[model samples]
Target chain A: MTKLLLKKLTKTFERRVIFKDINLEWNGPGLFGIAGPNGSGKSTLVKVVTGLISATAGEITIETDGKKLSPSTAIDYIGFASPYLTLYDEFTAKENLEFAVNIRGQQLDEAKMDQLLEHFSLLKRKNDFVKAYSSGMKQRLKIIFAFIHNPDMIILDEPTANLDAEGKQKVYDLVKQTAKEKMVIFATNEEEELAMCDEIIKILSYQPAGRN
Target chain B: MFRRALWLFNKDLTSELRTRYAINALAMFIIVTISVIMFAIGQETISAALAGGLLWVVIFFSAMSGLSRAFVSEEERGTSLLLQLVASPTVVLTGKLFYNLILVFAMNMVILVLYSALFDAFVLKNVYIFFFSFVLGNTGLAFASTIIASIIAKANSKGTLYPVLSFPILLPLLLMLVEITKRCSEGVKFEDIAPEFFALVSYNVVIAAVSYMLFDFIWKE
Candidate 1:
């Protein structure tokens, strides 16, 4: 139902090349992974995929239901979670969720909210300010936030960075359930997590073609 | 977009209540500056024009202190990414602008009351004109400040950049506000001050339109 295509993608910061000449096409429903060592552009590639940062050069086209979407419109289809992204620390978890949902113009799906909270074991602490949450709890909250809209494309960078084993299992289960009918892109160095992907792209592979 | 803006406004209000960041900064600057001015003029009667200009000077600096944090705080807290991912640029801009508008209006009303009582600057016949001018002026201030806040949010030296960017853009608006305030103090008729009103309204519309057109690039970049 959704497809993503990147053509000759190049990204550079201050004349230092991050990656170049990347081309790929992905169609959901499946799990895709972007894997690389640290500083190998794994995060940058994920950011590019989610439109969080502009590429130095290239084109990204997202098609849904066979309609090609412009970059601005394509953004609505993406849901992203990253260690770099932050929630409102001053707001309670429920208030944060409400704010996110309201901004997206979606009705509050209380059933889904209850399920996610119970699944993450956060139902009791939903009224607590996010600043009070532990890093693992915050990670679960971020993952939950990404799925709030049930977006056509979900991108998670360092998805399990600080999560405990139990949290990791919850995330893996959520990804499996999500990728069954949507595009899920995970950018991580962990081989265990990458093993879940149907396909993997090493970010290093796109490094300035043939330059060694 | 409007609904989203309201939601953001509420979020800002609640966050402000908890942290007291912008409000505390604005309140401190306002109280300190006004008290200093009152002491400086100790028993010295100043002209309406001088009083009007001083009022604007206090307000402009107070706004510069508080409104710059509208976007800067988001950037510092890393919440801008969350907003960028979930909301459109227009929606984000509208939300920030509304919050700034509420802050500026409320702060200005407090300043107006204090200036009137403390400095004897309320000797005007046409109070309605003053009220309208204050509303329109704050609207323009809100528009310019919100956009500038976003511009400076990404800069390395935000504290310096915010005021530098705001000064030139707000100069004309400030001039018009000062002129209108002076006229109001003198009990000038509404017809005599229509041009100033028109200028303030036009300034708000132009700044808002330009900011809306430019915000997508600024916000995403």
Candidate 2:
């Protein structure tokens, strides 16, 4: 079980407000969505929540299994997958996964690796260089990389960005399966994707009251 | 963290072998610079001090060419985010630092052999001082270069920013290296260069400690 609470969250870029005064309490073991139109601080909010970027003024308290986590170790419990993140193309998918697993000081578990590779339909091509994989395949590999460590919270920004209908279905199914045990923050505006969420948080673009 | 750093080192070694990006740049730079030096010094006898100075020039420039590749590759390939997500800042910095250390040590040893082979004045009567300076110099070079490389990787003009940042930061260390090299090649005894050895070790420690403290912010931000 994981809990995230954001208090008075405000983000500004060079005096230009992106979002402000956003307070939310999010709990997981269920699917949640952060829905916003394009350029409405969706990715920024996602990045902030994941501690990839700092909030301008707010507090993000992340508690997993009833223990409060500091910033340094918060990421240890987070599995982040996004288009903004990429795998090493110079490496084969297997080596890339191995590096990812090993870099966290955890040895790669062959059985879990096989299960994830098969889940993403990447088992057959695990030995192939990621450069040779299609974008959809690359996206699948990213998903496997994220889940390999069995993180407490899984955050996916624009999760279905490059997927075909079949790939999208696979993701929806995976999310369904994952949400049964792990917290999934699905950041997207797609109606179909949002509909699967147990709750949706809207982020509207910020405009000052006096501005036209 | 140590094991993870080793994994990263191996990953980098594999990538470097396949791409040869830094290796080619370093090789070409060394060959061209040495050739130019050979031409410039033709028919004129130079002191070992001057030879030592020239050798360090090659080292500094070679590092400028190759060392930044460690962090810059992560940025260029868009794998920086993945790395950020997977590892702690300490892990990332330690791992990259190890890779850079290996590169600096290997490149300088190659430069040392090549420089020794090409110059008649490059004598080493005090092998002990040369040994101490060589090891310490390479360590300091890698430490300072690793931090600066991470900085320049974030800059808009990466190519120009590296040397512009490295030159001033490395000036003190480079001066000590040249001085020790000159003394070593001139057959000065090892005991006389104690102060140089101390400075070199301190330089490496200070850079390593400061870089460790600051990398978290540089990396996360």
Candidate 3:
């Protein structure tokens, strides 16, 4: 079943058209990459899909358990991460994870949080304030917080933007692993990241064509 | 929903407990402001009227400083996005507002104590009236700060904008707060101050609802 579907998605900023009539869909349990250059509305596209921003004109529907979810109701199954968004710096990794779990109305799974910390190679720094973390460390923590609840669809924008070789590999592995059970929408410009995608969609620049 | 607010409250409390920057800055600002006021007034009558105004002036300025930093730690570490994505905007605002209320409330208590001590004033003749005034004042402070913080979050010169945007909107509430506090300080009965108290309460409710509805719009931007 299609987990998320966007039809005729259009967004404008300050009377300038960023993108229009954009159509996209995602079914579960696969890797989908949105490949584009800078200024291609990639991040905006992700934001619209996650309902972070409203579209100027279009419809977004999320299908789960044979039911179509509205925007407010659709949030429960979507986990989103971007460099532009991050966790609280004053909070320890453990505290941040616990807060995320709390918002989901679920009990804190200390064991799972610890495992994620270890998986991200942040176990040693789990107790430190995020302000004290490196850029790469902060990015990893953001991803961890997104996945802590095991949402059915994970939307990540430029997931490897600030990482070193080891950090990049860890994220690649994490995305690959997550794709086994949840639909993963990864938006990036790096060819290396795109090489791992099961399917790729290139966002084309605007061209004046005959009206339908 | 309350649980989510509590979670945010505890998270903020624990973090502030660890660093102590927000509370410490607010306390120092309050103390220094109070000391300056005492020196300026020099032992003159220091009317109950002026004392109440001074008390809120100290809180309002100190709270702007404290509340601006409330989101700094989150934004600096990129955790604010995590916060936004994990919970709905309403939930995020609720959590943030709740945490900020605690910070502002604590600061109010400290300011009240110090103001009473320095002014040689005994304002607690009716504990219930005093408590009601404090709650209304704190609610107004928290609600206004929450909306202003979101506005300042994205601005480059937030330092200048925070007070400029917040104070104008908050002036009426501040006036009401000081009026009720002054009346209570003079042993005025609850009924005497009821109208002002209700006005402050309504201000708080209206601002809270408006901010809550508008938060999603601001958060997305």
| Chain B TM-score for the candidates in order | 0.97, 0.98, 0.92
Q: Distance from true position, residue A95, model 3, in Å?
A: 2.8
- lDDT of each model, Cα atoms only? 0.88, 0.89, 0.81
CA deviation > 4 Å runs, candidate 2? none
Off by over 4 Å in 1: A205-212
| Candidate 1 residue-wise lDDT at B99 | 91
What is the i-RMS of every prediction? Answer: 1.5, 1.2, 2.0
TM-score for candidate 3, please give it.
0.89
Shift in Å, residue A184, candidate 1 = 0.8
Error at B181, model 2, angstroms: 1.0
TM-scores of all models?
Answer: 0.96, 0.98, 0.89
Quote the B-chain TM-score, candidate 1: 0.97
Task: Kindly list the per-residue Cα lDDT of model 2 for residues B1-221, writing each as its tens digit.
Answer: 79877888889899999998899999898898899999999999999889989999999999999999999999998888888887788888888888888899889888888999999988888888788788988999999999999988988899999999999999999999999988887788767888888999899889999999999889987
Quick one: ranking by lDDT, best first?
Answer: 2, 1, 3
**What overall lDDT, based on C-alpha atoms, would model 1 receive against the true structure?**
0.88
Tell me the DockQ of each model, to 2 decimals.
Answer: 0.77, 0.80, 0.59
**Ten-residue segment with the worst summed lDDT in candidate 2 chain B?**
B184-193
Per-residue lDDT for B1-221 in model 1, tens only?
69877888888888888998899999999999999998999988898888999999999999999998789999999899988887778888998988999899999999988888888854666789988998999999999999999999999999888889999999999999999988988989989999889999999999999999999889877
How far does residue B172 in candidate 1 sit from its true spot (Å)?
0.7
Q: For model 3, name the residue pairs that clash.
A: A86-B78, A86-B79, A86-B81, A86-B82, A87-B78, A87-B79, A88-B79
